[model samples]
Target: MVRVHPAPLQARLPAFSTRLLLRGVFVLELATASWGGPPVQVPIGPSAP
Candidate 1:
């Protein structure tokens, strides 16, 4: 015999946050470019495979 489970119908928050973060980084880059300073590096997470 075999059983199957259904996935939960949850909000895709991780995907949403990823997109939001990327947009934020782009905006930050634009702001920093106008400042004429060295680029700041933010360590958000470890590198993935």
Candidate 2:
């Protein structure tokens, strides 16, 4: 039998995917707020008027 080792990047994939998902949600929320769907106060980014 042969043994195999996981690459460094494979170990970090889960966390990277989670972060990507969260960022996608944030972008969607920002787009909706800009479209006047609802008031989502994003105090850290550019204000869309």
Candidate 3:
């Protein structure tokens, strides 16, 4: 049997911050693409495989 332990809120904060950072970067890219001509190809996440 395998047991899984939930992470504490403090431990998850960094991930949340990283997500926010990614979102910000995506938005900036979107804005830049809008200003430019062609569409930008943004990956889903850091590791998209």
**lDDT by candidate, in order shown:** 0.72, 0.83, 0.83
Better model by TM-score: candidate 2 vs candidate 3: 2
lDDT of 1 at 31: 90
Candidate with best TM-score: 2
Q: What is the C-alpha RMSD of each candidate to the true structure, in Å?
A: 12.4, 7.5, 12.3
The residue pairs in collision within model 2 are: none
lDDT of 2 at 12: 88
Error of 1 at 27 (Å): 0.5
Clashes of 3: 0
Which stretches of model 2 miss by more than 4 angstroms? Answer: 1-4, 39-49
The digit string of per-residue lDDT tens for model 2 on 1-49 reads: 9766677779889899999999999999888878868665667657554
Candidate closer to the true structure by lDDT (higher is better), 1 or 2: 2
lDDT preference between candidates 1 and 3, better one: 3
lDDT, candidate 3, 1-49, per-residue tens: 9866566877999999999999999999888877785865656887666
TM-score of 2: 0.55
Q: How accurate is candidate 3 locally (lDDT)?
A: 0.83
What's the lDDT for residue 46 in model 2? 72
Q: What TM-scores do the predictions have?
A: 0.49, 0.55, 0.54
Candidate 2: residue 21 Cα off by (Å) = 0.7
